[model samples]
Target: MNGTEPEWLLWAREIQATAQSGLAFTRDPYDRERYEALTALAARMMARCGGADETALLDAFRAEAGYATPKVDVRGAVFDAENRILMVRELVDGGRWTLPGGWADVNQTASECAVREVREETGFVVRASKLALVHDRARQNHRPAGPHSIYKLFFLCELLGGEAAGSLETAEARFFGRHELPADLSTGRTLPHQLERLFAHRADPSLPTEFD
Candidate 1:
């Protein structure tokens, strides 16, 4: 984990999520008020830990104005007939290879995000088929945080055809078999188990999609 998020900030994030959960379960107005106060305290702590203005942090917290939840992260595992996995290296991750993926946008479903990310990162047009796996990243024991709160949705994608190329976000692209996983995998963004699930899906179409 980077020193960018101090222990205090991490504590505040947990407290904030807990406070939101409390609001969901509490029925009494007094209990709701207490939860709100905890949320404000969490915001203040986050502000202090992140070196942001307290007022701004509080305002941002208030912007939600209701039960809050974490964001969703989605990824795609595009495979060829040979069962080789398509991977891309992103500049943000020091050009380390990963299966293409990104955060779920406001209008895009998990499948859409998967396909979108694949195309954007690898310049490959692919259709997201069955949802292969849904992983709780926090439970996955991967990195602390890659870019945002991500619930990884790895989908089985079929190539629709596009020239393999790199963008500003991606610097390299290639295909790999199970034994050829690059040493420079972006573990912070992609985990081995997550990829393993995709490989299993590719190996067996009967495997059910596991969700959180």
Candidate 2:
């Protein structure tokens, strides 16, 4: 998932982020009006070029009430006894497989989010053992580019117990050898190279944490 982002999309995201921050801190009436207008402009830009619904995008943008910042997504790389990687089929992505994880929740640390996501999505009880990587989702070139910027955290988790099972968000959970990964991966959630890096880290825990 290393692809170039469309220039317009990048500019639109910048505009949206700036406007959101302005709305969060501004007190002057004129500034508020300008930021609100910028939000609408960004929504129109995305709708026209990115093929998104303007109303929905605007609503989502306005739903945030804080200084605009990249959202965090946590992914857990849980390996089995045979050194195979644990993955789950995301129901939200039409059943495409990805490492078991999701958005980092408020009031939870990165490791906590990884542990919870793995359990919720795959029914796998795990302990987050190491932080492997922190990547910018856009910089990684994840597919189906999203409006909001995101920081993705990859953690090496220890598989303690629990059997493979599906939750509301996932269809099933399974482990795959390095050479047998599924073709249809939910790239927005996990990427091939990212998984390879995780495997490398598992092989040698001395590797330093990676960041983008």
Candidate 3:
């Protein structure tokens, strides 16, 4: 366990994961009831600690029926001729900037997901050149926003020609240099150090993929 995480958050996450796994595999009616109760309790605990709506949190938790696993988040690191990286201001995050990417879709490969996300969010067609990083979001100092763990995949991509345009999910799409990055970053999606590492990979293509 990372010592940096809050004790309450760690406890709540573990309880929620255990309950979810138990509910998924257990066939006994009595055991199912217990697991359900455990899940409810975990939800309540998180709501009280995190100041979220308990009922909504429980409903979200209950929506996932399978054995619990880390969710995959795909991100693209697309650089222009001047080495500036592409970024999008997310409407969901109140216009905070982040890398162009999102949750991996079921029928797509990781690279496909990255390329699609870039096109969807930033209106840029990209070809994934290489996987730059495979980072566990929890261990990467990203601000906690949800109960589920996330595995973030950052891909180095080549711009394949498209005008800068924003979709419903994004308000703006542009490129920025390291020193000129916006201060209002979507930390939950992209931390400063993570971006720094991406820029490093962009500069030196021979760098091996980073993993946590």
Candidate 4:
């Protein structure tokens, strides 16, 4: 575990995972009630720890009704001939820069999700060439924000076509060289070392995929 992660976040995530799994498999009415209470407790913990509203947290937890699973986030690392990396300024993160990516939609393959996200966010067509990394968000040196576990997938992609353009989720689309990266990065989506690793992979396509 990253020592920087807050104790409250650790406790809240474990409790939420347990409660979600319990609710998924328990069929008895009494057991269901117990699991529901546990879910409430988890929500309360997150509210107290994160300074979020208890009622809203509870509602969010209650809405998640299936077997517990880590949410998958897909990212694409598209390098141009100059080896600069494609990036987008996220509207939701105060216009901080990040690789083009988002939550993996249902019914889409991971590679397909990466391709779609890159095109949608940066208006640049790409073909996912290889799976570069599979990262556990908690295990990485990323800023903490949510209660659920997250699995981040980074793919090496070849840029195909399309002009740089911004979408509703992105404020601007551009490429940055290794030394020219923006300091205000959306750490929840992309980190400095991760981008460095992608650059390394771009230099040598034979490197094996990285994992948490």
Q: Report residue 121 deviation for candidate 4 (angstroms).
A: 0.6
Against the reference, the lDDT scores of all candidates come to: 0.78, 0.93, 0.92, 0.91
- Tens digits of per-residue lDDT for model 4, 1-212: 66657888888878887888898898899988998888899899888889989999898888897788899999999999999999999999788999999999999999999999999999999999999999988788688577778999999999999989999999989999999999999998899999999999999999999999
Q: Please report, as a residue range, the 10-residue window in candidate 3 with the lowest summed lDDT.
A: 1-10
Candidate 2 lDDT at 157 equals: 95
- Candidate of highest lDDT: 2
TM-score for each of the candidates: 0.76, 0.97, 0.97, 0.97
Would you list the clashing residue pairs of candidate 4? none
Tens digit of per-residue lDDT, candidate 2, span 103-133 = 8888999899999999998888999999999
Off by over 4 Å in 1: 1-11, 18-40, 43-66, 146-149
**lDDT digits (tens) for residues 1-212 of candidate 1:** 43444567667877777777788778899998998898889878866666667787667665654455677778888888789899998888677888887778987778888888888888899998889888776556665442124477788999999978898788867888888888778876688877888899899999998876
